[model samples]
Target chain A: MSNYSLRHLQELEAESIFVIREVFAQFENPAILFSGGKDSIVLTHLAKKAFWPAKIPFPLVHIDTGHNFPETIDFRDKLVENLGARLVVGLVQDSIDQGKVAEETGLNASRNALQTTTLLDTIEANKFDAAMGGARRDEEKARAKERFFSHRDDFGQWDPKNQRPELWNIFNGKKNMGEHFRVFPISNWTEMDVWQYILAENIPLPSLYFAHEREVIERNGTLLAVSDYLNMRGDEVKMTKTVRYRTCGDMPITGAVESNASTLEDIIVEIAATRMTERGTRADDKRSETAMEDRKKQGYF
Target chain B: MTQSGYLDMELLRFTTAGSVDDGKSTLIGRLLYDSKSIFEDQLEAVKGSSQKKGLAHIDLSLLTDGLKDEREQGITIDVAYRYFATPRRKFIIADTPGHIQYTRNMVTGASTANLALILIDARKGVIEQTYRHSYIASLLQIPHIIVCVNKMDLVDYDQERFNEIVKTYEAFASKLDVQDIRFIPISALEGDNVVNRSTKTSWYEGSTLLHTLENIHIGSDYNHLDARFPIQTVIRPHRQEYHDFRGYAGRIDGGVFRPGEEIIVLPSGFKSKIKEIMVGEEKVSEAFPPMSVTMTLDDDIDVSRGDMLAKPNNQPDSTQDLELMMCWLNNRGLNPSSKYILRHTSNEMRTMVKEVIYKLNINSLSKDESDKNIGMNDIFRAKLRTTKAVLKDAYRKNRNTGSLILVDEATNETVAAGMIV
Candidate 1:
């Protein structure tokens, strides 16, 4: 008998750590895809705990689109240095320069989709049979059906219909040569779980997460951070507003919510009260109902 | 409160097993639906799919057929996971298929389940699929078995039919190793004795499915006698501020771990004393099964992946030869001479099947001794010889140390699941 009760966050952390250990034991060559977001950061922390007394055996892979928040870059570098783990950055810009992928050109163009080419190339080059990601099932519709050990074909396409059955704690990370598995140890975790885990762990994150005074413009009910990447219409007036990002992605696309939740506990409370999902704040997902699914099929993590 | 009440909320993972039309999906859908965990959009989508299929009402089976092919074929092909939470506890539901060819899926789903929800249509009493599911649940050592008599409304809510099915199931279940057996008459379509007790069934005394699920005793599911923590990785934050920090991170596979306890790491045969148990700092004094934490030891020892830690006095057997019941999943038959990767808990190693003792006839629950080769969805008892010694116990004794999965190297598919004897 004990005096303490396991909170919701503790349960989720335990489950995620259990899954991470399973991945480490099952896969030959596995890597954690670190995007420096809160979810990925929480994943890294869990991975660290999954293998205590020994360093994380797998390297951290960052699919760098070259267009990233400077704060995210700083967070990534600091975390990698402190953990004493290897970092492998698959540069989308390099892939474009190398002619492996063609860059998209448009008014609202971004390198989000092009990251898939570099990611697939990196997996092939490094022979990463299993790539652990921070993808949560509650984030989107298509992701809800994703298995823990998501199989990818030779072309790096996700065939949702042919996914293998994953039951219990047994994750099948088996793939033929030229094929790979996208492992989501946090498949059962939701956004609230991630935030609560972060709060409990006291894990550090980029400044973009907390409320800060920044120049922003309201566009289609979304607060877009005023950056050089954005094409400001004359009617869309920019004003300095205290806002915090719900999800950190490309600076040109990710939206900021009108928030004053500077602390982890505050963030958790705010998220609990919010009605819309986290992806609702991102402009990229707003492009189409199946935007995330379409990008995921092309091997974008 | 009693001492047991301290651990009131125990995790209950269960599998729903039944043939194609036994209302397995409907039962699961009803469970999730009544729990209020089904999102509105998901419900709407399922309703849309049902309407498109020309059904007069929402087909609850549409919830479990997640895959496109399964939806198109109007049958469950693979095991789908569903989660729901009630005030008492959270539930992880493994919705497994019931086709004879999908026997492996049932075994996989039931492998870690604490309960087995074996649905039997009141009209079809104790069929082969029911026997197969119940037998496999017993083989897997699922702590609880609830033989749900589904579609009771179809049989005009007949208590006689329910009683006959229970008697037939009990007679057969007596031959198998089952701890707790329960029966409930449910109308998944009409929602009787599922979420709310049915008014029509005044003769029934047992609680509803949801009520039983929320109150089932799952505290004894874990083997508290054995302490097993397979080391997944080592954490040494090399910064100057935390230069002396050294913690072993892994989930507690079995038993309880506390600070100041003496422990020995397996394979390396190194002894160490636990200095602190940290769950992301605020050092914990104790930890138990399924809790993930970092522990700093008194001395630095050589502990790496595939190695397990336990109390020095009570150690698991380190043996190469293990007898187990294996269920093959892939289309390709087992390569008798080929080496495969066998994963147990966090330990993985190359192993080979020494002999196929006997394949269980899933339909008839009979043993076929003449068969030497095991193919897809074949459940067989066999002896396995691993390249390295594994610390193991009977599946019934300790699920953490007793269960394993065999991976096919050539195809890179999880070919089979095995239970240590």
Candidate 2:
């Protein structure tokens, strides 16, 4: 056990820190795409350590769907205040109010897809050359081929086939004036690794992640929290299930799981034995097989 | 978590090179399925797709065929990284494409790999690709190579066919620089000797592919004798408690560093003592390769990003002239007069291609000294003249310090990956 090699979690952490610092050094302006999810929470914590004692240099850009769970908003505000980092909010509600995007009117209607417009507009408005995200490759098939430093056109579109070949530790962040980059520091991390690192580092997370009694509607075999943003339809009876969200996304799109994993240790054990990928719980992905790949091309985080 | 031995699990990154027809993706899918890494929902999606496409059996390759175009064409055009873990180790498989874009994709995948899986059809004893792939693996200095003589089911699990292919590969690979080479007979499509011991190959005594991957000694893959830290950025908090804290933040490229160790900064050639290695505010007594840490120096010298700190006695070479074996990635051919931005570790300097020594005919495993026109997928040896001296080691000696990439000034795309000779 007296070896110098690092465990998988440690190695992943180091690689992520290196990438964060590279974003700071390579781009004129870079902001973290924080979604108040477990993945983004871990990413922000790593940024804090990446430049110890120095507050995170870049601001956190949240593409608020305006349909978020109150817990996620509250958690986001508190974390930002604690880190003394700046928070930039891009409201999809604003996009709707300005007649920029139309809301879908259907049973599976969600503001999840509208976040792309807000996100792209936010990046352009802020003139951010790079947006560091918490996206992991193992989450979906399209992401499995994503580069750590992914390129984006001026329109903030992802060209999977036309990406620059990333080699070794060197990241190429160079682009035209109008073009930008979407950097995924945690591209190599898996769902299990994220939970493991969170436990090992004692990183604080949103309480919504812990099992709690909540009013939810079981639709399509997945639990959706009953929030003001989501109204139950006929025969979509509300069930007071002790559930925790596997992913922190928009209220209508995110799905919850039946669990009693209130403690971090319990959560890790639950995740280890689980037979589902984290993104599998996401309702938006069920719309189509290429749902994620399509949104990613249109600049969805 | 600790009771499950999760804490002790190490990481291993490997590359797989073979076309779809050779069952490369099928092998990866088998590994994931047997390891329980493939989730139920994902399997269901694959099953649904298989049914819609009228596939007789579940097409496992669909799982790795990611992008829309790739899925439509039933081919992989880029290197898709796949993850699977057993209890013993976490595996990151760089499933490199084996199509027309072979060399560039394989080089990118092999750069950080500890082992490479070169597939050979049992029926096709030794093909041109076997030589090309094995050469690239050796050129990149990958530590281990597993020649998976696949489709044993097609060959009736004949040990003689597998043995013949193994001997042919060994004779060709002997001319290369790789150290550890092994052979395995398996049928990735039929789930034989991939994750489980195959009774079909009763004459084979070697371990299964998964077993070898789990048990391979990868601790020595990193260079531990030389401590080289290239400063990525300067972490100057300027806070009240640590007003004068000037920590050099970087990942150790090689070896280890501890407090009270004497070191020297490159280019400036300034001497300093290791004050402490800080992970955050807390101090770590020792730091090693791939671990990013902030270190302070006892002596207050001018140190910034792109600066290297190494033991004075064991320093790397620094010179304006460099020799490198580079793989051209961009579509535009190499122009000798054009200057490219060469990035080595944390250092970036403008450099010009002084001369092209030779272009490698990978399929033939020969050097084409007369082919100076380096095009895409071409690996060529060349001399570079840097604007400033760079601290470097041979790629074979240390991958971290020895490797670099060239960025086109106009396109800004990474055009070439260079391995110092």
Best by TM-score: 2
| Candidate 2 lDDT over residue span A161-190, tens digit each | 789998889998889889999999999999
Poorly placed runs, candidate 2 (over 4 Å): B1-6
RMSD of 1: 4.5
Q: How well does candidate 2 score on lDDT at residue B371? A: 75
- Worst ten in a row by lDDT for model 2 chain A: A1-10
User: Model 2, B1-421: lDDT tens per residue?
Assistant: 1112248889999999998889998889889988899898999999989899999898887777788898878778888999988888999999998764668999999998999999998888799888888888998999999999999999999988888888888888879999999999999899899999999998999999999999999999999988999999998777899899888998999988999999999979999999998876667888998888999999889998898999999999999999999999999999888999999999999999999999888888688898799989999999999999999999999999999999999898999999998
Residue-level error in angstroms, candidate 2, position A108: 1.5
- Model 1 error, position B404 (Å): 2.2
Provide DockQ values for all models, in the order shown: 0.27, 0.64
lDDT by residue (tens digit), candidate 1, B186-211: 99989999999999899999999999
What TM-score would every model get versus the actual structure? Answer: 0.84, 0.98
Q: How far in Å is the alpha carbon of B69 misplaced in model 1?
A: 2.2
**Candidate 2 CAPRI category:** medium
> What's model 2's lDDT at B166?
82
